[model samples]
Target chain A: MIVERKSVDLGELQLDSGETIPSATIAYESYGELNEARSNAILIQHAFSGDAHAAGVSKKDGATGWWENMIGPGKAFDTDKYFVFCSNVLGGCSGTTGPGSTNPATGKPYGLGFPFVTVADMIRLQKGLVEHLGIEKLLSVSGGSMGGMQALQWAASYPEMCASVIPIASTHRHSAQQIAFNEVGRQAIMADPDFEDGNYYDGPGPGRGLSVARMIGHITYMSDDSMREKFGRRRRQMSDESSLFEVESYLRHRGGQFVGRFDANSYIAITKAMDTFDLSLGHASLGDVFEPFDGRFLVISFTSDWLYPSYQSQEIVRALRGRVKDVAYVELPSSYGHDAFLVEAGEQTEIVRGFLASTFKKLTPVGAAR
Target chain B: MASAVDTAVRADFVPEVLGRGDYQIIGEIVADGSSVLDLGCGEGELLAWLEAQRNCKARGVEISPTKVQKAVSRGLSVYQSDIDEGLADYPDQTFDYVVLSQTLQETLKPRDVLHEMVRVGKNAIIAFPNFGHWSARFSLLTTGRAPKTKHLPYEWFDTPNVHFVTIPDFEELVRRDGLTVQKSFFLRGDRRITYRPSLLADSAVFLISK
Candidate 1:
């Protein structure tokens, strides 16, 4: 279906770092109609590099949303049954107020001047958008990777806002290795001469550095087995100088593609946000963080996902075991590692569809809707 | 695959009768409106049956990821867990019934697992193949090898039943553990066998409480 982008002025967002954005505009897209009772509303959070266009053909780029396969009329999100909404997060470059957005204070782009945004901050902005839509309690909040972190934050920070939660291929906290990988990407961007201290909007920008950073990030997204299956010891055809390995060529292509669509500063800000994402940051334990959540939970993980592995999802499940009454967890076997949630949509669809169907049934009993 | 669809259609008509194998009998035994925790609940067949037939709140713990996925797809709350690790997360007598159906023989420490199940639930329902059945004894005598019947189909080398116990053996363990057998059902296929169950029954189902 042809979906259009909608924007809402969130006024001023008091960020977690004691910084404030004078005016923040959140770009969002919606599918289906919100029922009269507004009980069928579902909020889908996007991943690290993902945008507000979660489903359907994007109006701006004419490309499909990242989760297009799973959010259609009869798909997992099931637009026919539920009103699904996805918003570009705070510090996201996609139509949202981010590093690229013009700063009202200096009339220049925020760029490096943008204060760090945490997963909690992103959820707060999302809450504003949900409130703007006039939805009191969301039927569910779901997402993968950074989006999954946002989903967890929503369940923890605003426990009563959503009736159910689905956090797929994600973790409650970033591991030391996760932080190190993000650090490498950030250093790559900073090392770029053309970065111009994040004021390269009028210039060529950190194209090479951002491309390199994306390449590094891309490797972590895929498993060794998937990479091997896709391109083993095979060599790519190149002119005269030297032959390129198939995997090397693939990484280059992915990195080049990423640089054209994404902003460098926003990547830095978002990754930093993800690094600081610990559900039990100030709490005594993970159980204490999830104590307030009284919703059905579906925690999914991929077998080959070493970045945010199945063990990480198990940690969340372990914490929620006796704490939450209704929690379902599945570690789907997939060759595609951390990117399995994106790549393995067909398998995910069945699990998500069943979960949403059951959760909806519990929320709205037979004849209760009338 | 068509059979699965047929089963789904059949479930809509009469859910209690739709369950396959021992699950059908287990579904009948579980009380209506009760809370059940099915340990080693492969693909949650029994839990799903319990939910549909008895309108019970059913949760499952299965070790296999593939089976867990299948169970979740059926809209059952199934967790991927090894029962041998214990059920410390669940408080004492949290559930009305904790079921260890046809999985006791496969557990590394059957006694420890049973203890956890009994500790967590008001009552425990256990079902396992009777290794001392007449057919198994006959097969062992004739073939001069480990018995392989409908209930115990696997060969000794490939068998998952690491600690196989007969009806008499299980009853002995139950008595030794200070658990009272509230009810018991011995089956030869779908038919209930009561007289000389240790030699006649292929599988045994028991409802025990401490």
Candidate 2:
């Protein structure tokens, strides 16, 4: 129920090429009491297109959001024990200002005119929000997928701001295979006639193109085993009974559901941001990216997630172990693929609870160690 | 808890803290933070220290129930398993280091246990009192009986040193199996016998890699 919206001056968002977005607005939600010591505050970074409403049933549409499984009273990131914060990214559709929002200067949707944003840029904007909430050092920062990328960036960029980090089902950089997949999705949207070169804001915009794009994304989100188990070649019971393929039906349902809640412009912007997200892109190496992050780390990966496989998590742990053994990694056995972090409740809940308990034990006052 | 543990422990006990001969030999061996599976881990003292000081996690296979209890009480993790039956439950390369310490000479099937150790670990560390020491040679030659020293403090009938091996003899055996020696250390009392340990030392330690 506790939600808020605020626009902060991020100076000027100078694009990778040569452009500038004069201003930006960041939407965020905060819950639980921040302890007096200011160490119990946890920042929950939202994934691609995911809004600040990470928990609770939506007031507008009587439905729960993506991470509703674990961010409640007695959940893993328990609001009862720690302060929780989640915010819409720099370029997102849901409540925060994005390409679909009106430009204060021209009084029209920014569309493609919105400045290109990076994972680092998202972390920078979140820094403003965290400071606005009057929290100094975060007890821990955690998230999955795109959210996981932000957590990694937060720990790498602002090492002293948090005591620990838990990045689930994420990588330090986008692999060539992932970039190609996103590129095809973007191409699908642009090829649509309704796309209108990103200017069809008032009228029917690239819904079909965006739906197809989501279909491609949905395939990657789940594992083959998960799809086979959920929807086999069972006939949909009709006169002819020439039922659609199980995967076809499943993709159609997911695509329709996404199109209902999301904007095509937002998809273009967020996916582009993810494509640009390579933490080790310009850094000396993977190890150097984490050299500054001296805090304890709990990195988890799913056994079935071919996208951002366990090797990526291992790379992060290997880099950290080069410095110290404060890193703990647990590859949970699951068949849910990349989405396992959100769906595999039992495995994630146990690992996170155990990790937090251990981190808290280490971070407890020095006098308590004896 | 500390007082209760202290009261239960016997007082006359002074752990071998590795004499100079043992220390010099063990120092040359790789005792880093490896996944170690130690056989006949007495009191689990060395394993616990390795874990604490070297970040090496270890699992001990001890035959003595009393020693297993003592090791567990000291916060050292251990399992009661037999070595001769082969480490069938453990997969290949399950450990980086498999150590026999000073108990290899006492095993019923030393060769079988050594082969199993090599199979489970990439490398193995073995340490034993040298039966070829000058004192042992003198006793055998003059008294026509097995020699006893401070290091090998047991009578001929009760001694566990059945597989009596010397530095050169152990080297020959290790070479016969095509195993390469990573390092070797000779121990004489609390000092290292680096010059001619085969003839001068009381104990020898060798680190071997298959």
Candidate 3:
């Protein structure tokens, strides 16, 4: 199905940093129909560098959704059975009010002058959109990576609004290594001469810098085993400055493509939001953060995902189990590294399909006739 | 975490799905509406059965990723974990029943597992093949080999059942550990063998407490 992107005028939104955006708009896409009780709504959150197009062919460019594999008619999310909604986050370039958005105050793109945002602010904007759609409580709030962090935030910050939370290949907070990698990406963008302090709207922007940053990101997203298998020892040529590795060639192509689609300023805004995100911040412990929450949780991690390892997922499960809350956990066997949640959806399709069906069944009360 | 709550999407839960006699006996031992943890729960057939038929809260730990998938698909709460290394995450007296069905012999440290089970649950229902059965004994005495009968089907060299225990051996350990055997059921296929059960029964199930 060809899907059209819709935008909601959410006006001003308060940031976690005590600042406020003059006007906030969220670009979104929805699949399936909302039932009478509005209980079948499942919110799909996007990861860093991802847009609101989570499923269906986009009308703007005819590009397939980012998570099209698992969010279609009979797929894991099963749009036919549940109303699946995805929104571009607060500090995103994809039609959402971010660094790319025109600032009402100056009649120019926010660029470097955009008010700083956080994961909490992202969810807060999404919350406005979800509530605008007339959904009181989501049947589930689900996502992977940064999306997963949003999912956990939904369950934690708005416990009564989410019936269940699915955080896949994600963590409650960024590890030192995770922050370090994101920092490198930010530095690559800032070092570009064309970047001009995020005010490159009148120029070519930071295309080269953003490309190199994405190249670094692509490396962190794959596993050693996958890299070896994908581009063995195949070499076309050799040079001191240019080591003609096929992997390097491939990364360069991917990085260049990323620059064509993503904005460098938004990249900085989103990454900083991700780097500072900590679900347990200020709480005595991780367990303490979830003490008042009663929503069910489903936590998934991949075996080869060193960037966001299975142990991180285990920590969430451990905290939930300690509270005697309803939770399930599995470290699936995969060689796809951090991209397993997106790349490998076969077993996840089965596991998610089952988990959602059971939860929906419980919510639908059988009458005395049964 | 890919392992926990996405509650509403599991397959249709069919009550009375489990037909195993030992599971039925164990189900009887479990109180209605109580919480249960099944170790080595396979695809969580018994846990699903308990949840649907008995209105009990069912949870499980299975080592295989494949089985964990099946159980989650079946609407059962299961963790993918080795049973020996699983219970440490849970607090004391977390469950009404801790089940180890046909899996005790495969454990590297059976005694330690038993101890952990009783510590984690108010009661534990253990079921294992009786190594002292008449057919098993006859096979060992007559052929002078590691007994390979219907119950203990594997050959000695490749057997996964590393710790072979008779009814007497288990009872002695229970006594040594100061555990109380609340109930016991000896089975020869579908029939209960109360007369000389140690020599006649193929498998045995015991409901014990600390």
User: Mind giving the per-residue lDDT tens digits that candidate 1 earns over B7-121?
Assistant: 5644553445333445655665677799999998888777776786668998999899889888888888888888987376766888899999888999999999888888888
True contacts kept of 1: 0.60
Please write out the lDDT profile of model 1 over residues A143-214, one tens digit for every residue.
Answer: 999989999999998999999999999999999999999999999999999999999999999999999999
lDDT of 3 by residue, B60-142 (tens): 88888889889888767788878888887778999889999999999999999999999999999999989999998999899
Which lDDT tens digits does candidate 2 get at residues A1-370? 4334434554555555355566766777666677766777888877765788877666656566567787877777777877887888877886666788788789999898877777787787778778877888888899998888899999888998988888889988888988888888889889999999899887788888888998998888889899889877764653686777777877888888887778887888888888888887787767777777767677778889988898888677666644432555556678999889889876566556655654555566866532
TM-score of 3: 0.93
Q: Sum up the clashes in candidate 3.
A: 29
lDDT of 3 by residue, A1-370 (tens): 8999999899889988899997899999999988888989999999898999999998989999999999989999998899999999887999899999899888989998988899989999888998899999898999999999999999888888988899999999999999999999999999999999999999999999999999999998999999998898776565666576789889988999999989999999999999899999998878877877776788889999999998899889888877777787788999989999998889999888888888887777875111
Q: What is the lDDT of residue A75 in candidate 1?
A: 92
Q: What is the DockQ of each candidate?
A: 0.57, 0.05, 0.58
Q: Which of the numbered candidates is closest to the native, going by highest TM-score?
A: 1
| RMSD in Å for all candidates | 3.8, 11.4, 5.3
The interface RMSD for candidate 3 is 1.1
On the 0 to 100 scale, the lDDT of residue A198 in model 1 is 96
Off by over 4 Å in 2: A1-20, A237-242, A366-370, B1-210
